[model samples]
Target: MKNIAIMGGTFNPIHIGHLIAAQCTSDHHLFDEIWFMPSGNPPHKEDEVIIDSAHRMEMCRLATKDHPTFRISDYELNRKGKVYSVDTFAMLQKEFPDNKYWLIIGTDSLFNLEEWYNHKKLLKIGAFVIVHRSGYDEEKSLEQQARLRECYNTSFMNVHMPQIEVSSTIIRQRVAEGKPINYYVPDAVSDYIHKHNLYQLGDDHEIR
Candidate 1:
């Protein structure tokens, strides 16, 4: 059976941290393919200033182009209305009945697993790989993992990697401040952000 791992997020600008996590996860050889799935409209981040879906998708494409195992998926991008993890997993399960699916997330996400939309159903559908970040509470992670295993028979794995202290929000803030964001994001993404003048002050573009 094919093992596919999914790393889903808003990917507001697709930074180096995201790439490193995905690459380290891939290095484990736990999955046949690692798909970078960008959400169209993140329900949890409704108040945040998200960039256009087209641009986010393009940046993800550019960021993962050099990696043979890395791929970008438009599953959530093409879906209408609110996108939930359970729905995405269900669709993939139906589409690839022979393949096993795994959901990859950070420690922060693991702590809030119960708060996600239909999270119990999501856990029942596929396994989870939690990537440990610096300062993350190991005890809490283990507790949550055990709870899920006992309650839903969910499978879990932990991956350790060097943490990169970069976030899309910080990158956007730097751009808005007219500061250089070199090395924060990939070169192609940096150029795209500059060429398009994204995240600049007073630029009134509707975020969808």
Candidate 2:
């Protein structure tokens, strides 16, 4: 069976950290293909909205351009309303019944799994590959772990990668301050931001 991994996020400005996590998870989880799906509208954080869907998709494309196994997906971007993980998984499961789909996320997001839309059903459709982030607990309570084991048939695959605290918010703030964000994002993305003058506009400027 073909193994597919889905990495969904805002990706305001895809960074090296995100790339590393994707690569690590792809290898560790043994996924045949890893698709970076940029969410159109996320229900998690309203404070930091998504950048333009086109630009975000391009950034992800540039970030994973070097990896043959990595791909950029605009499935969620083309859809309207808040992007739900369950909805995406269901669609893929229906299309590829022979393939095993895995959802990649960070340690922080796992903590809020209960709040996600139809999270239980999501587990039934696909497995989860969570990346480690500092300050987030990797160890789960025995009771909770047991429940997850019974409910979703999950497995914990740990990866050793550099801990990068740089975030898209910081990248935007740096752009707003006229600071250099050279290494924070891919060179192509940085150039695109400059050419498009994104986040360089006034305080009221909306991120695409």
Candidate 3:
């Protein structure tokens, strides 16, 4: 069975930090491929305005174009209602029964696993690879991993990743302030954002 890593997110704007974390995980675990699955309508972001799926998906494509093992999936984008990773993973497992799936989540989300819809079943879908997110306590993350392992009887591995302080929110704020996002995101992504005028005006306005 091919080992695949699923990186699910809203990706309001694909940034360097997202790529780095996925790269680090891919290198550490030798995943066959890393699928950047953009959530269409995340339950958590229901109250927040999300950019058009076409733009987000295109931005993801531009951001990971250089990586041969990286791919973008529209599975969640085509789904109806509020999107949840648990349902995504479950469907993926059924569709690709021969493949071993690994869910990639940041340390921040690691702590909030229980808050997810049917999180336990999601955990049962496959192994989880936890990557470090900037500004989170490493010790606490390790402790949480241990707790999860004991509670769920599943394998949870951590990847050693270089911390990037940049985030989608930061990039959006910078663009709103007419600042450069040169290093914050891939050049293609930066140009695309500028061309499409995305993430400006504090994410309150989404490009159609």
Best by TM-score: 1
Clashing pairs in 3: none
Query: Model 3, range 95-145, lDDT digits (tens) per residue?
Result: 988987788888877888878888787766657888976678989998987
Instruction: RMSD for all candidates, in order, please.
Output: 2.0, 2.3, 2.4
Q: Once model 1 is optimally superposed onto the true structure by TM-score, how far is the C-alpha of residue 201 displaced, in angstroms?
A: 1.1
Per-model TM-score versus the true fold: 0.94, 0.89, 0.90
> Candidate 2, residue 4: CA error in Å?
1.3
Q: Which portions of model 3 show Cα errors greater than 4 Å?
A: 133-139, 202-208
| Location of the lowest summed lDDT over 10 successive residues in candidate 3 | 199-208
TM-score of model 2 (CA atoms): 0.89
Count clashing pairs, candidate 3.
0
Note the Cα lDDT for every prediction shown. Answer: 0.88, 0.78, 0.84
* Worst-scoring 10-residue span by lDDT in model 2: 136-145
Model 1: pairs clashing at backbone N, Cα or C within 3 Å? none
Per-residue alpha-carbon lDDT of candidate 1 for residues 40-106, written as tens digits (9 for 90 to 100): 8778887888888999999999988999899999999999888888998899999989998888889
